[model samples]
Target chain A: SQTIHQWPATLVQPVGSPLSLECTVEGTSNPNLYWYRQAAGRGLQLLFYSVGIGQISSEVPQNLSASRPQDRQFILSSKKLLLSDSGFYLCAWISGGNTEAFFGQGTRLTVV
Target chain B: AQSVSQHNHHVILSEAASLELGCNYSYGGTVNLFWYVQYPGQHLQLLLKYFSGDPLVKGIKGFEAEFIKSKFSFNLRKPSVQWSDTAEYFCAVELYGGSQGNLIFGKGTKLSVKP
Candidate 1:
């Protein structure tokens, strides 16, 4: 069975601080990885998605950037996070088209 | 741009009560539908999906959803809900409009099942 892991289950950062959230998937190869942010009482917003190593597609224009350093490792980064960037960040992977995705525990980032 | 819409923002029900959550999407061409659940303080988990098959699809925890192509709707249903079912339900649509990497989601419907 495949498992997805996300670190720093909860985080609190001040505005203008840097941010880094990591996501790794085990037991799968060449999987599609995605980063999403869920605001308070709002639907998820796709921040970035990676198809392969060194390949990333950003959805929203924000302070966040995503990178696929390895086939199984994805990283979300922010040089300067804004207060609006505070939300629940989730990482997910899909086997392929029409396949359901598996999500990690998610990182609750609260930017003060 | 593709988008999804979940009709009910919140719903309250009791144990053994029926469940039905509406999910609609805006995208032409072939599409895929999905229903995900999130327990309190937990991450989102896939409950059911509709790709290419019978419209009615069954998922974990006795949850089910039906897809109506003409209506562009995939509604989730459960004959009996439980207290453990108290969670937020999300309707996600995989962009199948002849595109790659879909999974657009709706605002979500928060279901509160009482004991």
Candidate 2:
């Protein structure tokens, strides 16, 4: 069975501080990885998605960027965080021939 | 541009009451439909999905949804909802044969079931 691990279940970062949230999947290869932000009343917003290593597609223009360093390791980073950047971030993956997505326990980031 | 619409922003129902959440999408081509659930303080989990074949699909926890192609709607239903079913439900759509990476989601409907 495949599992996704997202770190820092809860984070409190000062404004303008650098940020890095990591997500990695086990038991799967070449899986599609995605980063999503969940906000109050806004539902889930797709921030970035990668189909392979070093390849990322941004859905919204904001203070966040994503990278796929390895086949199953994805990283979301920001040089300087903004107050608006605080939200529940989720990592999800879908393997070949599978349309159903599996999600990891999200990171609740609070930028104060 | 592709978009998804979830009709009910919030719904309040008593235990054992019937439930129905409406979902519709804007896309001309073949597409895939999905329903996800998020309990309090938990990760989003897949409730059900519709790719093809049966228009009606059964999901976990006695949840089911029907896909109506003509109306572009995938409505979720439960015969009798429990208090434990209190959670937010999301409707998502993916363009079939298009970019598999982009899974457009709706704003979501929050369901509150009173015991």
Candidate 3:
């Protein structure tokens, strides 16, 4: 079985502070990784997705960026946080040729 | 741009009542469809999926959905809903043969079933 782990279940960050949220998947290789953000009472917005290591496609141009350093490790980062950046961030993984995506426990980020 | 639409933002129903949730997508091509459920304070889980073959797909917990390609709709249904069925349901779509498995999600429908 594959499992996804996301760190810092909740975080409080000051404006203009750097941010890093990590997500790692175990028991799967070369899986498709995605980063999504959900505002309160709103639908999920896809931020970034990667097909392979060092390859990322950004959906919405924002302050956030995503990187897949290894086959199972994905990181979402921002140089400076904005008040609008506060939301629920989720990491998901889907094996190649599979349409169902498995999501990790999301991180609730609050930028004050 | 592809987008998904869920008709109801929130619904309240009594136990044993029939349930129907509408979902529509704007994309003209081969696509994969899915319905995910999120319980209170829980991660999203797949309720059912429609990749190909049968148009009517049955999922866990007696939930079923029919894929009507002509209408670009996939409506979820249940003959009888229980109080435990209270949850947020999300409809998602992914373009087939696309390079990435990017799923476009609809504004989820929050279902509250009364015992």
lDDT tens readout by residue for model 3, A27-98? 988989999998767778899999889999999999999989999999999999999999999999976665
Worst 10 residues of 2 chain B by lDDT: B96-105
Give me candidate 3's TM-score against the actual structure: 0.98
Candidates ranked, most accurate by DockQ first: 3, 2, 1
Instruction: Compose the digit string of candidate 2's lDDT tens values, residues B1-115.
Output: 8899999999999999999999999998998889999999887889999989999999999999999999999999999999999999999998888666468889899999999
Please compute the TM-score of chain B alone for each predicted structure, in the order given: 0.94, 0.98, 0.98
lDDT of 1 by residue, A5-105 (tens): 99989999999999999999999899999999888678888888888999999888988999999999999999998999989999999778456889999
lDDT of 2: 0.93
lDDT of 1 by residue, B34-80 (tens): 89999998778888888887999999999999999899899999999
**Candidate with best DockQ:** 3
* Predicted structure with the largest TM-score when compared to the true one: 3
DockQ per model, Cα: 0.67, 0.71, 0.79
Worst 10-residue lDDT window, candidate 2 chain A: A94-103
Q: Sorted by TM-score, highest first, which candidate order results?
A: 3, 2, 1
TM-score of candidate 1 versus the correct structure, residues matched by position: 0.95
- Candidate 3: the clashing residue pairs are none
Clashing pairs in 2: none
Cα lDDT, model 2, residue B1: 80
Error of 2 at A2 (Å): 0.2
Provide fnat values for all models in the order shown: 0.57, 0.69, 0.71
